[model samples]
Target: MEWDWNFVRQIMPALVEGVKITILASVLGSILAAIVGLAIALARRSPHRLVSRSVGWFAEFIRGTPLLVQLYFIFYVLPDIGILLPPLVAGVIGLGLHYGTYTAEVYRAGIDNVPRGQWEAAKACNLSARQTWTHVIIPQAIPPMIPALANYFISMFKETPLLSAITVLELMNQAKIVANTYYRYLEPITLVGAFFLAISLIAVVLLRWLEQRYGRMEP
Candidate 1:
């Protein structure tokens, strides 16, 4: 079928709304993933064997599962247990949690890469664990981790389409609705691909900048 500029104009508004929701979900979900991942990484490093082992198992379980299944449970199954989250909220949590496990691995690797001498020095200085973490380890570890974390967040942004399965109405969902309604698959689907391509290109550039900036470690 021929492309219809008129039809494109008509659907731009709805698609724009979808774009907003998509960005909102990606941003919120990325923030949550970062926080949750850091917590999981720290928990896994706990001195207590039970706490560390249990947390490690939980993170592994989350990483092992499909995000689509996790989304279903968050949006559908949780309501059965009186945990009735709105569609968008559930989608954000689902994205956050599923990706948080992966991000936890990134955090774990970043933290582990810190020099053993740094830990020894902190101990020599009589620094408390909190002070050592806050002042030294995090400062060193986080810089190198920034690029990896950004890459994961970018992947999460691309995965926003999965939110449609849970009825969150992101870009892919909007495109599908438009296609089904007008029975014209070309315009909407193509436009969604263009939008994602443009955004991914921009993200790649930003990722390069992050790699140049924070990817370098200071001695």
Candidate 2:
């Protein structure tokens, strides 16, 4: 089909809403992933063998499974057990949980890279465990993790379309709706690609800025 500027214009409004929801999902999901990942990383480092092994296995389980399957399980299966969530909430949780496993590795690696002396120093200083982590370890570990975590953020943003499976009106879903409804795939599909490309470029710029800003270890 020939490109239809008018049809593009008509769909712009819907696409705008899609962009908003997509951004919202990405932001919320990234925040949750960061928090969950840290928790998993720390738990997997517990002194108790049972706790550490169980948490490690759980993280591996999540990391090994496909994200789509997890999303389906959360959105569709959970409701069968008296747990119901809004589609956006379900999608955010799925994205966060699925990606959190991967981020957990980043967290673990970052923490490990902190020199053993740092931990020894914290102990020598009589710093509480929480204070050591909060005041010393995490601050230092996080700088190097920025690039990896930002990469995951972009990946999660790209996968926002998967949210459509649970009825999220993200950009791709909106595009699909427009295409299916009007029987014109060219304009809407192309628009979707263009929109994604634009956002991705912007995200790249932001990632670079973050890298420059926080991707360094202080002397």
Candidate 3:
């Protein structure tokens, strides 16, 4: 097939719509993952051995499993047990959960890097546990962790294509549909690649800026 400028233009709108869905899923998933990761990190640090070990094992299991399998289970398998979710919801959950395990490690590392003296100082001041974490620990830990978290956000964006397996109309899924409908693979697939490359390059530049701004402040 000759390069079809007309077809490319025709498909652009749908592809752009798909791009919006892709970005939405990534942003929402990243937010959920950040929250879940912090919870896991904190739970793993609990004074109770059972709490810590169980959270540790859960994190390990999630990290060890394939994301695709997790997606399938969330979207397909759970319905058998009466938990039905929309495709987008299932995909978001799968992405958040799979990446949350990795982010938990990043959180753990950041939390660990906080100076022991900070903890001692909080104790000396008789600060409550909540006040210490709020005022001292998290503020110190989060900045250095920003660049790493941004990298994972970018990774989650790339992985949005996998949501197609569960029927979410992300970029790759839209591209496949466009190609199938028009019987022209070249333009749609190439455009999908171009879109991903453009976004990824932009994210890389932002990641670099974040690293420069926060990495040097590491304690």
Candidate 4:
């Protein structure tokens, strides 16, 4: 079929709306992932063996499963257990939890990269464990981790399309709706790809800026 300019114009509004939802979901989900992942990372590094092992197993479990399966379990299986969430909530939870596992690894890497001497110095100063973490280790570790955390935000942005499977009506879902209704997949799908590419490109530039800004602070 020939390129359809009229169809593109007609669907532009819906696509724009869908893009907004996609952006919101990605942003909120990333926030959740960052917080949850940090907690998991700290748990994994705890002196207590049980806390560390439990967190390690949970992270491994999440990483091993397909995101689609996790989405299904959250959206479908939960209702059977008397817990029902809206599609949008389920989508956010699924995306955030899945990416949290990935970010935990990133956080662990950053925390590990903090030199042993720093930890020793904190001890030598007679700092409490919490004081050591807050003042010395985290201040050093978190700067390097910013780039990785920002990268996860971009990754989650692309993965928002998976929300369509659970009917979240995000960008890809909107595109698919337009294609189904109008019987023109090329324009809508092409627009979807272009939209995602544009957003991802912008995210990459922002992440690089963050990396450079933070990288300067490290000794």
Off by over 4 Å in 1: none
Off by over 4 Å in 3: none
Per-residue lDDT for 216 in model 1? 86
lDDT of 2 at 42: 96
All candidates: TM-score: 0.97, 0.96, 0.98, 0.94
Weakest 10 consecutive residues, lDDT, candidate 3? 210-219
lDDT string for model 2 (1-219, tens) is 678789889999998899899999999999999999999999988999999999889988988888888899999999999999999999999999988888999999999999999999999999999999999999989989998899998999999999999998888899999889989999888888888899999999999998898778551
- In order of TM-score, best first, we have 3, 1, 2, 4
Per-residue C-alpha lDDT of model 3 across residues 17-121, encoded as one tens digit per residue: 999999999999999999999999999989999999999999999999989999999999999999999999999999999899999999999999999999999
Q: Mind giving the per-residue lDDT tens digits that candidate 1 earns over 27-125? A: 999999999999999999999999999988998889888999999999999989899999999999998998899899988999999999999999999
Regarding lDDT, does 3 or 4 come out ahead? 3
Q: In every candidate, how many clashes are there?
A: 0, 0, 0, 0
For candidate 4, the lDDT comes to 0.92
CA lDDT of 58 in candidate 3?
91
CA lDDT of 168 in candidate 2?
87
Alpha carbon RMSD to native, model 2: 1.2
lDDT value, residue 10 of candidate 4:
92
* lDDT values for all models: 0.92, 0.92, 0.94, 0.92
